[model samples]
Target: MEILSKNLQLLHFLDKEDMAGFWKLKMMILKITSHSWRNWISI
Candidate 1:
């Protein structure tokens, strides 16, 4: 039971870390997409 609880805690921590990384990646993609669109329109 103790081992299981520890594993759950680790999983939760990893989930939060992944969520943060996912958000950062999403923002980067959005920024790149918007920049490309602006360039396309300017051209």
Candidate 2:
């Protein structure tokens, strides 16, 4: 849920052809997913 919101925020912030923004957004999404998975495993 949080990840989805953050992803939407990133998409809203980034313009087309903004490679750096895309890269950052990608990394943020990956990190968020990884974090979520870790949390689920710990629970």
Candidate 3:
């Protein structure tokens, strides 16, 4: 959880630095994690 939060902070910082790539990467990560969470909950 700490690592995740740190990574999220890094992503946010990168988003501020380079909006386009950051937005794309952020969305992709969000989609992947959201799907994983859903699957985990279902199990």
Candidate 4:
């Protein structure tokens, strides 16, 4: 459900060609994934 909303927001951003927002979102996801990976490795 949350993923759906994020997808919709992503679509809207792309429609507006919001590169800064898109890049920010991309960086946020990357940061989250990397953080999760580090936690998993620590365990």
Q: Highest TM-score: give the candidate number.
A: 1
TM-score of model 1 vs. true structure? 0.66
lDDT of 3 by residue, 1-43 (tens): 9999998888777645588876889999999999999999999
lDDT of 4 at 6: 98
For each of the candidates, give the backbone clash count. 0, 0, 0, 0
Model 4, 1-43: lDDT tens per residue?
A: 9999998887776754577777889999999999999999999
Candidate with the larger lDDT of 1 and 2: 1
lDDT of 2: 0.90
Per-residue lDDT value at 10 in model 2: 85
* Candidate 3 global CA lDDT score: 0.87
Largest lDDT belongs to which candidate? 1
lDDT of 1 by residue, 1-43 (tens): 9999998887677877798897999999999999999999999
Local distance difference test, per candidate?
A: 0.91, 0.90, 0.87, 0.87
Clashes of 2: 0
Candidate 2 TM-score over all chains jointly: 0.58
Which candidate do you rate higher for lDDT, 2 or 4? Answer: 2
Among all windows of ten consecutive residues in candidate 1, which has the lowest summed lDDT? 8-17
Please identify model 2 stretches exceeding 4 Å from their true place. 1-17
